[model samples]
Target: MSMWIRIDDGVATLALTPPADRAVFRTALIEARGAMLSWDVASGQRFPDAEIHSPLEASAWLAEIYGEEIAAAVRAAAATSLPVPGSAELVDAAHRLAWLMWASDWWPAGVYTPALNGPILAAETAVAAHAVEHLLDDEDAVERTLHQAVDAPSALAAVPLRLRADAAALLDVLTGLADDHGIALSAATVSTSSADWALAAGARGQIREGIEIGHGLAPVRWADVPAQTVAADSDARWSLRHIDGVPHLHVSVAAVPVAAVPSTEAPGTEAPGAEAELWARFGPESLDIDIPLQGDSVGFTGNMQVAASIALLPLEERTLWIRDPLLAAVPGPAESEDDRDAVRAQASIRLDDPDASLAERAAAE
Candidate 1:
């Protein structure tokens, strides 16, 4: 397998693989970039460089994984023709391919050395990228990782990829903050999960820590962004950041909860019943939650202030109830009901500390 990596020991020199061989991945990036430059000029809307590169970079790595023929259209774009598909379609297909490599065991996590503490999460992402890249030469693994990336929380094993131990520790700090603010979340049993978001040089890009985070896990684009707190374990000091308001929490290098499945009577929902621990982020520091009980009333805690007069969701309607409030917060620039609805489709209702604006801390407190 063609290997790609960078080693830096905080020195002037950095070790690395031969630059992309000026090969299929690079070729694809060039094509995607050229096409996008023209597309942007024609439209008079300046698409960011990162956006263009995000999908393209992923495609090149994918071509390395699956087969050149798999990326033929994308590669063709460089010298002669751009991929026949649209940019969005191209991005989706590439990630599907890269991840499929891992699903097939072509890129098992074992081959890479494990990190005990420093940058464990970054190492994991790097390992995943390496494994998938190594598998590109093989056809079978490419197909599998693509399928798994598309499926999610499906019959597919969750992979425990959420890094629950680490996220749990972050959550403890968050919940404590929530308690201090009296911010309460609706009582809905929510669980968290994650997917590796990667993009290659495409028509767009995003610079994370100076390196592109790729389009795969770009913050604005992730759908079904399920996030939740870590389950309690006596030995673990970690707490889960169940609130979805923190912008960067679940983006790159972070695990997210996707859907809140109700644990109580009414199944297939995100409502607070007898076991609701609704953790939500109002602003960066504020968290809102709704705890459930048999009676109509709900409870609140943390560094938040919930109006006692606030209404709690009925056990059955809790998930949808949280959904509505969040939907209302979508900004005024929404182009259509569909665009607005799309936002709601991805989020649910969790109580806010009423002080949940982005700058609630600097402004009021």
Candidate 2:
């Protein structure tokens, strides 16, 4: 019957009276739930400073929507003893609790405002510090952002707290793998939907980016490495490079085609299917690439180049296939005009230009 928001002592408190109509109340609860989750994600970004106070009203706010059970859980999580630094479980718990507060409509304005209580701010700072430490150490996080310099298309989204927890869990798993392989990661990011992540290691002068990829929805690990571009077109070109004398490939793809589904048909058997039947499948948002021709194809193999070759297939029906695939790769700077030309020639394959060919450009040189 009533909804109110109040900010006091850097904490925002929300109170709501349930509506008489069940349907109306349900809608309001749903909106509040979404707001809370969003707040958890945003609040995790920066530690509670002078501007943010604890969501002191989280328990009451949650009770109105989800009842006392969830509210109790939030309070219990908050009161739970803080964990020692570098403890993954502790990090997970802290972030989870913070997010629960946000999702519960407790953290007003998506921030953990400072409170007069020292313990509350201390606990929040611990979680925020843990997350920020890991992110700062991850050099690939910086590299991922830097890819924009080469015109690699990328996207930035508001990462939710659940995803943040999942990412922390994954980081724990990978930290062990890195230790075993002597692979020291400066920075990394985990994507649950893609079940993959990009990591960086080596000293400051010799940092290298490596990708950990999952197989068909399975989570990937350090052992499952050697990430390479599997299915690619001429436009998605790659070249060898040596950074500070350490050899690695520099790949640049304007657009990546969706991979083809691995057919279950028997070998040498032509599955009954039209060209259109095959082309409609979309690739995963994140791919575990083992490039076909470049580097070592350790993790993946076979030509499932669905996106690039789909246009060449004979089809009875005309359908529009439009995609805004993010630009990808870590192509080092070009060394020469010829190299620049070659890179340009290969990168132009996605263009509608029929005359685009790396071979022609090579001959002209």
Backbone collision count in every prediction? 76, 17
Candidate 2 per-residue lDDT, tens place, 27-122, comes to 111122112321113212211111113334343234433334433434443322221222222224333334322312221110011101111222
What would the per-residue lDDT of candidate 1 be over residues 220-270, giving only the tens digit for each residue? 111111111111000111111323322121111111111222233212212
**How many pairs of residues in model 2 come into backbone collision?**
17
Candidate 1 error regions (>4 Å):
1-62, 77-122, 130-300, 303-365
TM-score each candidate. 0.21, 0.17
lDDT (CA) for every model shown?
Answer: 0.23, 0.25
